[model samples]
Target: MALFGLFRRKPHERLGFELYGAAVRAARQPVFFTELAVPDTLDGRFDLIGLQVALLIRRLHRDPDPRGPGIAQAVFDAMFADMDFNLREMGVGDMSIARRVKNMWEAFHGRAQAYEAPLQSGDGAALAEALARNVWRGALPADAAQPRRLAALALATDTSLAAQPLDALLRGEARFPALEEAPHDRDAGA
Candidate 1:
């Protein structure tokens, strides 16, 4: 059994790390921090990473290909492993690491659930509401413009993900819409 395990290659391990790297890149977009008013704190960064990861997972779940699920699981494993390493780097004690990781997992799952409905519905209002509640954490900006812009960006991201080929996603070649290209609501005249 041990020999078999050693001989078996984890099919998506490398691709999973690549995908996680992509997610991290998406999370670190400068526009999100400067234009969108996303706080630069740890919580804000985590939320952005969680959002990107959730979107990728959602795309995987909706893919008809049989390999989608396996790739998705590998992506998830990569994400949590990165998170664990990050926590340790931040000086979290060994005894507290497991509990902190569990809490982060719960948070990620909750955010995924919150994002799923709006993303599936393709409704701007619903997407805005979900982002406000979760991303902004009920502390929406004094003006509604930032939230509106973020909602538009989120929709663009959803569309971009939907358009990616399943094979590309599985190969860790997924791409997100650039922030500058996120469409604004014409009706709002902004």
Candidate 2:
């Protein structure tokens, strides 16, 4: 039982943080959807958003394209601000907020390969498009498209990369209370 402590968490949990962080770093543009788990009941909300951002950003980073780099980067930046605000509104605390955010990032990052693998093989468009519409369309559409379209537009427009180090930045440790020194009356020539 003692040895299990080192291997307790699932593989995804153990390395997801760094993996997600890397995905975030690799992106050349910001993603539009930065907030992960909102106060709602939806599946793949955050993961899909992250993947969409990654794919578009990855392409922009690799090859300098006119349409890909500029706007994509802007969107990614905006996503982060929105994410921070949303998280705060969700009533997250300083101590665990970073961990939660980072964990979610890692989970999405780890899952990115699954989402992206199909794109490489030209078989991912459907799933990709489905994920996109579900995430960005505001209202979840109820159409019988059978094999749904996983649109890449959301990926092309997300801005999650803008606000980073959210956990590190929000942690209470970063803001130690201002230190007060013993009162010394310099004006009185003490």
Candidate 3:
């Protein structure tokens, strides 16, 4: 007959907390402090929340020591190459795809920098939260009903450094003038 006992939701709350704890546990990894830390190279231009998430993912997934120098650049080159091929299969030409991909990478870099600037100027946790918000926004799947694909994205995204598929990552927000498709040529009556 205890009122306290009747009101107790502690068990349910605890279970919920533990579930989240396990998820974070699954994401955990060790990496160099400097490597995991947001690079000074950002120089303050991108979204803070997104950059923090990027750093968090980088810390969890990237190796502190790579086989060669410029490992980041090499990784980016391979990612863009894959993106280029995908674009080509979708009917974009090699030159157009290359240009668009390069522009998108630059935009990503710039966005990182924008977020970093405010962080260095004294916004810390606020900046991290903002970046987290942006990350969540970016994480929304174009099609939400694909649960299997969504779960894979949740897992893959937590450790991924690859830019999103070009269609999402590029096609404007991160670039100038925007990409316009060329009109198809019509043949004279057969």
Best by TM-score: 1
Per-residue lDDT of model 2, residues 1-190, tens digit only: 8898886753223223333344444332222223221213323445444654565444444443354344335434544544565688888887777787676656545555555654444443444444445444434332322112233322222222222233331221111111011111221111
**Which runs in model 3 stand beyond 4 Å of their true positions?**
1-69, 117-190
Overall lDDT per candidate, in order of appearance: 0.81, 0.39, 0.34
Cα displacement (Å) at residue 182, model 3: 44
Q: Report the lDDT tens digits of candidate 3 across residue range 23-82.
A: 223223222112222222222212222232333323223344442123333333443454
The prediction achieving the highest lDDT against the true structure is: 1
Model 3: lowest-lDDT 10 consecutive positions: 181-190
Predicted structure 3, TM vs. truth:
0.33
Error (Å) of candidate 1 at residue 86 is 0.5
Clash counts for all predictions: 0, 23, 13
For model 2, the stretches where C-alpha displacement exceeds 4 angstroms are 1-44, 65-78, 125-148, 151-190
Q: Please estimate how well model 2 matches the true structure, expressed as its whole-model Cα lDDT.
A: 0.39
Candidate 1, residues 58-90: lDDT per residue as tens digits? 877778888888888888899999989999999
Extract clashing residue pairs from model 1. none
> Which model is ahead, 1 or 3, in terms of TM-score?
1
